[model samples]
Target: MERPRRGWEIPGDHVVCMYKIIVTPNASVRGVASKVIRYASIGEKEARQKQEYERFNAEIISWYETSKRVGLVMISYPPEMFDAKYGGIASLLSVIAGWNVSMNEILRVKLLDVFLPEKITKEFEGPRWSPDKIRRKLRTGGEQNCFLRVPIYPRLAYPEDYEHRIKCLLKKAPEIAPDIIADSELLFNHEFCSIDKRIDIMSKFNKHVESMMDAKERVETKTGCKTLFFINVSGKPSYTLEKTEAVKEAGLDGITLNVLTTGFSLLEDLRSKFKNLIIYARANAHALLTRGNSVGISFDVLAKLFKIAGADIIYTGAPCGSLDRVKPLDDHVADIRHRNTIVRNPIYNIEPALPSISGGVHLGNLQVNILLAGVPLQITVGDGIYNFPWARNNLDRIADVIRLFKKAIYIITQRKENMWDDHEFRELRHKKCRTYFMEEGKCVDPTDKEIKDVLRRWVYPEFRDVLEKWERGK
Candidate 1:
């Protein structure tokens, strides 16, 4: 049988928005060539006969050529040029980013931004579960005064080459429990550890699936808190989908998708197919992030695009913790999540996509991360808990780490005078409380440098060894 169509395809008749982008030429070009063809006519002899066929559709809005290496050109197009029905992500891209990439020799035309119309955004089913729903589902503990849903995702590994890591975590669940346990993104791709080629992915993943279910049981029985377990489904598109189907059939909670590895178009396709499965889109900085450098796409644009494409949770970079000098990126991501009205497409009542702050997040700067990322955020940490030097041998000590981190988050979010004003964490607070705060349906602005400095100061110095290891490996 013919292979099933991998996903959605861009048809020729889809309706699109009046999209525009700025194109910068590699070298200065003549004015005639700079304009994108809109109503080109062939030679006089064939012009009459081929009038209908010869019209190349696109309008050049503006052009600025300052020098040989630097020049800017703006292009606009009518919505009728795109195939609206079958073109979800791919169709939209064909107009915005698809063709211009290959034209680098003549001009470095990059997509600075697009003003998407309501007609286009309405086609997507944005996040199925909002931040509040996710918080209720996972039940990361806090009070009314406490910022309710700052969920945590802790990356895991099978240390003993068995299901020992998860089992240990479940046994310690009575004391400390993580909101979500996630497989390392590289694990599914065989980069973290080599698996026997003979073993099918289902067989390799079966034990983890069972272990996650077992952990769920223990958490419910002991702590009464809910937990979500997401397995990394990373690989070629077809293979990843196969794994996803197996996980869904097995009753696992979700899948962690490295969107960079799978392709953004594929991610949207999966979202359409697996409506119930929670998809965590991790922008691993391998694909879109690198491509974004050449184009003008920043983390902010990428995050909002993923949301429009129906991603539930997106990995929105780390600021001042493990990765350095990305505070602006993080702030813009949070802005998209909380202030969806400002940055999102206007047609749909799309719930704000949850922005997850990852990369070296731990108990030390956990409070800082939560504050900076804003409430209703998701926090992901790996080495911070697993490789804690003091708890290297004792798995039970993870409870203390969770307890302390939650305590810190609660104190900072609630701003309880008695709890932190005179406490040790008092020093962790910014002298001016520089954080994203709600005001008139928007986040109050704070300089990226100020937030970065305060968060850096709050980082736990004890984890220097772990941070050093991450830097070296990176």
Candidate 2:
């Protein structure tokens, strides 16, 4: 699935948009290659003939390397999306054919991957975590992502000069696993404690962690999620420990910690204390990826490393949305996960964790997102859902979008259980899904597999294509 590139503007309702991506099909399967063409659906073979068709068994890898566009992939959206004022899908073809757009000139890049809630570049727009509402809106039984996010802001503000605001932030968390994204102020606030090897009760942050333990019951009841809070623990570690311990005691599930900024041992300590806590590992060194370093571990490897350090999940920025979309960088993400398989570190016995797709994810990229993130995707949308100008009932709409995404995932991935696999969450995805939305008191069957197929082919794709075209450059 593709994440929107930065600098490429968009609108909430508009359907079609032009997308540019760099793909190294050579590293695709060995890296991010989604499917093998030799063994493809019958109709897919015919479609392959129409566009750029590589040798059937000669390998898609060859086309990836030899094409003068040599990994350059630019596609136009559905034709209906075009107009004289705003060119349609075909216009994109014309632009690429006539214009010479350089990778360096593009400001944003969308990193395509399987998980939501991954890391994002600072440049990518509202794709940034707003400390507001965003993400999937589940309204039917079909739509359900194991993790359902609820927005909870810092209820109390710390004095500008106060040293303990970070302490206060951790203190306020009712629960911590759904994953929290705070502004930088909350991330590096001097008042926040560091991760400590030994848990302490006397520390102000420690006290907050202990306090949240009591509040856990209330939080669990309120969100109906047992371990669903990711606190603002972006500061350094020993103090990060107090935050981790607070997470442990409060039964809060995770915290977003910058892995590159802190050592792996910090995560190790937190993992040691709480066997089940989820850590959202953030890595900032991914900037090197766009330059085409296939061997370096890159940010994707950081996910593997963090998992070794005890992170439950890691954030990989998007090719677009909150960051510029760079095709080469997207290839690097695939390389990190596929090519650089993490060797088990002697530091600890660890399992393969999940990668998150963060930055500017919203209702718009649903299908392409699943395609890009791969199955079992975890995407974070800070403003995409909340920032809608035409949305009438924003809350319900968000939930509806979430539900649609879940249903879409189910349909697209062809999996029945485990909406969130790595975390192994089961019932959580069900929370957002309602089997039916009433129409005249009669249950409407919107999700019967047959009807769903009809809608996807006959409806959704067309409509999505239509609006996306005009959304470009918005």
Candidate 3:
């Protein structure tokens, strides 16, 4: 296995200077990366020279030149820019990115990584519940806590859907208890779900949460293990505050906030405002892309930001998952989990945040993900467990999958070397049926034909017409 490594070269002066630069839409007189600095300074003469000569030099951020249009330039900032007394993650970022956003029409700044001084880390609280506390609280399958998340597409869906989903989970709660059962971001409160302009948003939301709470009680009664249910509460500050209050009032365990959508600053606010509720920060490619052209956040930088903002758990890319272009996935996971690894800044002792492996995770790739991301994990699988070929059988099949998943995880975690030689491991093949297309050891991107085939196979005779209509429209 290749270990993660970093290389830094500083001149004799020991000045912290050099920023990796990339150009966006607007082009300066020359195709050089210095133009990015021009845009980053937003054409401020004094600032540009300081950024170029005094503060730092330029180096390209990317490893390769994918395009002549983009240049990765490194820049170093002055020490005086950091104010120790009023130090914060947001303030530090503002120093780096303040003028850049307004610099050019499409000039964007994505932080590949940041060096957090002790002064900065001490500014905000880290995770309240570390991995140990979380496992202790949830009472997982064995020594390790396996995570499960069920995605609910609609609150207004038919009763049987919830029954089959929640009730089935309730039945399996006792024997195959997972540490966390989170709501997918898909099931968030949206304007479309509201009934009328006159209707109070929280009133409708409270009604929906009531059903979830009732279901949670039933599961806890059977399981004895207190399984936490996190509802995806993401929106504007006003809407988010109202829903968060409603979630707390309803006696729910926690709420999931889409950090990229709500912004990192909002996460800090929620962390301060609601001390009791467990805040889980979530983000996907789609959500992050919507953050605006000026703002670009890399995987590791995003992790540190969440930690600084006080998120208990943050989702990371799976080594072999649906999301693409996330190379060095193992390194990204480490960036979140390992303390004092981001940089050797003397000021603050930054703690580790729980790294969550989600997206296209299943029984097939459980051990593989563990090996890549490292153990003491929060693995959230959706279709891998729920959409299993034989999962419909409430009593036996779901338990079987859970047991096998735990078994594989246990072996790999206990014997790290076993990951290399699968000959020692069992369960080489899957017993369940699946409608979606997938590939081994990589994320599945099913072709159009494969999707159509799955739809035809799974859809009932009555629903075939609707499926065909949708397909035709596509």
In order, candidate lDDTs are 0.51, 0.36, 0.51
Of candidate 3, the 10-residue stretch with the lowest lDDT total is 194-203
Give all TM-scores, in the order shown: 0.67, 0.42, 0.65
How good is model 1 by TM-score?
A: 0.67
> What's the C-alpha lDDT at position 183 in model 1?
66
| Candidate ranking (lDDT, best to worst) | 3, 1, 2
Task: Give the lDDT of residue 49 in candidate 2.
Answer: 75
Tell me the tens digit of each residue's lDDT in model 3 across 182-288: 55576555454431111233233334434554565524322225556666778788888887777776656677888877777777777777877788878755435
lDDT of 1 by residue, 1-474 (tens): 221121111233222221123345443443433433322222334644665744435556555555455444445545555554577767776655554334444434444445455556667766766666666565544432222121222333333532445454544443345566666666764544332221233244445534665666624322225546676777888888877887676666677887766777778778888887788887776344424333445444466667777777776554425553433654444433333322222224556666676666655455445544554456676666665543466765655555555555555444422223334434433332223112121121222455544434432343333333322422
Model 3: lDDT equals: 0.51
Candidate achieving the largest lDDT: 3
Backbone clash total, candidate 3: 21
The list of candidate 3 runs beyond 4 A from truth reads 1-18, 22-73, 78-90, 101-110, 140-142, 150-160, 190-224, 285-295, 326-347, 392-400, 414-474
Clashing pairs in 1: 13-83, 14-82, 14-83, 14-84, 15-84
- In model 3, how large is the Cα lDDT of residue 131? 61
TM-score of 2: 0.42
lDDT value for candidate 1? 0.51
